[model samples]
Target: MKKLLLATLLLLGIVTTASAQLPKVMLKSIDGKSVSTDTLSNNGKPFIIDFFATWCKPCNRELTAISEVYEEWQEETGVKVIAVSIDQAQNINKVKPLVDNHGWQYEVLLDPNSDFKRALGIQTIPYVIVCDGNGKIVSKHNGYTEGAEEELIEEVRKLVNK
Candidate 1:
C-alpha cells in the first residue's frame, strides 16, 4: 500500500510540473525579431499563446473571433494574446499580411520550424495555451467552435479574478 501511494504521488508530481511553464525554444516574430518562447509575458498579467497556421481556416476563424472582442477582454482583465504562426520558414512572409488584413492587434510570433509548437507537443493548429501572470501555464484548449473565444476569455478571467 505504501509503495502504491508513493508511485501515485510521483506520477502526480510529474504530471503537474511537466507543463507548468513554457518550454524554452528559439522562434522569431513576424517582424523578423528573434524571440524566446520562455520570455513571452504581459507585464504580470495573464496571456494566451495561440498556435495557428496561415493555411488553417479554422485557426483563422478563431483568431478573427478573438480579434473582434480582444479590446474588451484587455480592458476587463488585462489579458494579452500572442499568436504563434506555425508556417514554414519560406511561408513566413505570409503571416504579417494576413494579420494586417484581419486587423489583428495581438503580438504575433513565427514558429517556422515549429520548435515552439513541438516543444509544447501540439499536434494540431488552433491550440490555445493560457498562462497566468507568473508565466505558469494555467489552462489549455484544443480545437475551436464559433463561440469558443468567449470560453478562452473566461479562462483568463478566472486567473485575473483569483
Candidate 2:
C-alpha cells in the first residue's frame, strides 16, 4: 500500500507539471509572416518566445536585458529569441517603432488578436517561453528583473546541450 501510494503521488506530480507547460500557438510577424509554433521546434535549435507590450516598462526591461547578452547567446548556443508583441490593435502601431528604437535584433511578431497569448494562458506582459529543438516548451518565466535574461540564457544552454 505504501509503495502504491508513493507511485500515485509521483504520477500526479508529473501530470500537473506537464500540464503547466505552455502550448504551441501560431503567431504572425510584424511583416505579416505566419509561423506555427511547431516550426520553431524540431528545427535543430532552441527558440525563445518573449511575450511583450509596447507600453509595459517591465517588457522593455526584459528586452533590454536580453539584448545585452543576445550576441553571446547566439555565439554559444545559437538560440533564437522571438519577441511577440501583445499590444492591442489600438497600440499596435508602436510595435515597429519600439523595436527599431531599441535596436532589438530578435524576430518581432505582432499578436494584436492575442490568439497565441490566449492559447498560452498569458495574463501579463514580459512573459517568456523557451522550447527545445523538438519544439517542446521546456521552461517559462512570467516577469523579469535585472539580469533575468542571464537566467534565460542558462536555461537555453541546458536545452541546447540536451
Q: Which candidate is the best by TM-score?
A: 1
Q: Give one digit per residue, the lDDT tens place, for model 1 in 1-162.
A: 999999999988767753599989988778888988898899999999999998999999999999999999999999999999999979889999999999999999998888888998899988999999989887788899999998899889888888
The runs of at least 3 residues in candidate 1 whose Cα sits more than 4 Å from the true structure, single-residue gaps closed, are 1-19
- Write down the TM-score for model 1: 0.90
Query: How many residue pairs collide in each prediction?
Result: 0, 4
Per-prediction TM-score to the true structure, in the order listed: 0.90, 0.84
Please give the lDDT score for candidate 2.
0.83
Backbone clashes in model 2: 4
lDDT of each: 0.91, 0.83
Write the residue-wise lDDT of candidate 2 on 15-133 in tens digits: 66444544556777888888875465435798899999999999999998889888998989999888989899999889999999999998988888898888877787789988777
Specify the highest-lDDT model's number.
1
Q: Clash pairs of candidate 2? A: 41-135, 42-133, 42-134, 42-135
